[model samples]
Target: MTNSPKPRARGADKRRRLMAAAAQVLHRQGVERTTIADIAQAADVPVGNVYYYFKTKDELVQAALAEHAGGLAEFTGELDKLPDPLDRLKAMVGAWVGQRETAARYGCPTGSLAVELDKRDDGGLDLEVGKVIRLLLDWVERQFRELGLPDPDDLAITFVGAYQGMSLLANALRDPEIMTREGNRLTRWLDDLPSAREDGG
Candidate 1:
């Protein structure tokens, strides 16, 4: 008889499920509106079991922030595979465009969360949100640096800020096509940059 697949590690699997579910629920419902029981139900794990992994809702939200940071790392890593720096930047724009529908439905995942968390006097979680934004900014800066742009940092900020502003507009207007149009404009901006090293060596 064919051998059956091995059973997954229950403890680790539950924690992973809890973290993923926390991210999803927190994205759908803001942190102020979400609770441990909500995440437990979304994760399909017992409410008591959630405490075994995270002692409180704040801890669970922290886990979700870490999960988002991890996702950002993976995202930049994929962009690293492309040979052209401009292409990588353009691809990033394309990714935002692809998520237009989701953005319109619930706003940019990290952006909305950060805005909500920023209103609080609490310290740690706000820093975690900064880390996520930093990851994207730093990655974009590196691409501009490689392209020999004189103001890589400023360019990176502009690039990412434009996307963030567009995301806000898309959500505010409930229009997904705004992202598509802005993405195309951003791609054109990238393509119009000087092909030669701007620093003149």
Candidate 2:
């Protein structure tokens, strides 16, 4: 008897589906309420299959956090396309505000994960969140360096802290307009920096 053709590996596809499902669950139900069962159901996979990929709920949470970080990294790439560092900074801020607005409409997967991950004193989850934050901070610092700033690290930290604080406030108040305004103000401040001014001139 002839052997039938073997199915494709499909492992990558299955992993992507699981991550997408986890993001949906986190966005809709909040990270604390999201369960393995919910992710399995959302992905249309058996519980055993989910367990095969993730040994524990925390592992799955970390995977979801990685996915969120991946998305932010992609946003950084888009900002890098701009020639001017000040423009790049503004684009980055605008992209973040736009993402927050979109997430508010459906719910924020990253914000939900951040809330839970931040509370834990020790875990891989916190590390995953740190990775995401660090990536964004690094991107911001790169822009500052390109602008010839004297203190890229400090300025990047300040920029990221202000952005995150404004985002949390906007999300809490359910006010995208506030986020937009504050983000623009911050961007303008960066643009007016001496280094940026000389670069632009």
Candidate 3:
């Protein structure tokens, strides 16, 4: 009799399923409402299977946060295509606000988790959110550096802070128009900066 092909390791498959399900749950319901049982049901796995990979709900939440952060990193790659520093800054703000609007309709998995984690003190979830936010800030700084601006880090923080604040305001008010107006105003302000004007006419 021919030997049957060896089956894939069930442990690896189960972990993958759990992560995927966690991502879906966090995206749809936000981290506050996504329980272990909910994740198990979504993944079609036993509740015990979740604990096998993550000891606590917070651990699972961190994993989901990391996955969402990875997605944002991919989106940031688009900013590298622009040649102008001011233009790059504009693109970054536009992309961020546009993403917030998209998420508002379907739910912002990353932003939701960020807000949830912010309310808590020192913890794994907070650390994960901090890493994601730092990554975004670093990307902004790099864009400023590429544009030949001095103190890229500070400039990036200023620009990102403005955009983030505006995003929060727009989201809270359930208005995309506010973001659009603020984004345009930000772009105009950036264009008027000394560094931008020094680059060319």
Q: Which candidate is the best by TM-score?
A: 1
Clashing pairs in 2: none
Query: Residues 1-201, candidate 1, lDDT per residue (tens digit)?
Result: 997545457788898889999998998898999999999999899999899889989999888988888888998899899999998999989999999998887888889889998899977788888888899899999999899877999999999999999999999999999999999999999988886565475
Q: What TM-score goes with each of the models? A: 0.92, 0.83, 0.75
Overall lDDT per candidate, in order of appearance: 0.90, 0.76, 0.74
Poorest 10 consecutive residues by lDDT, candidate 2: 102-111
Candidates ranked by lDDT: 1, 2, 3
Residue range 1-201, candidate 2, lDDT tens digits: 997544445666677888878876776776678789999999888888888788887877777777777787887777777788788888877777776675444434565567777887776676677777788888889888877788899999999888777767766777777777887789788767787455663
Candidate 3 lowest-lDDT run of ten: 102-111
Clashes of each: 0, 0, 0
lDDT of 1: 0.90
Q: Ten consecutive residues with minimal summed lDDT in candidate 1? A: 192-201
Candidate 1 has a TM-score of 0.92
Of 2 and 3, the candidate ahead on TM-score is: 2
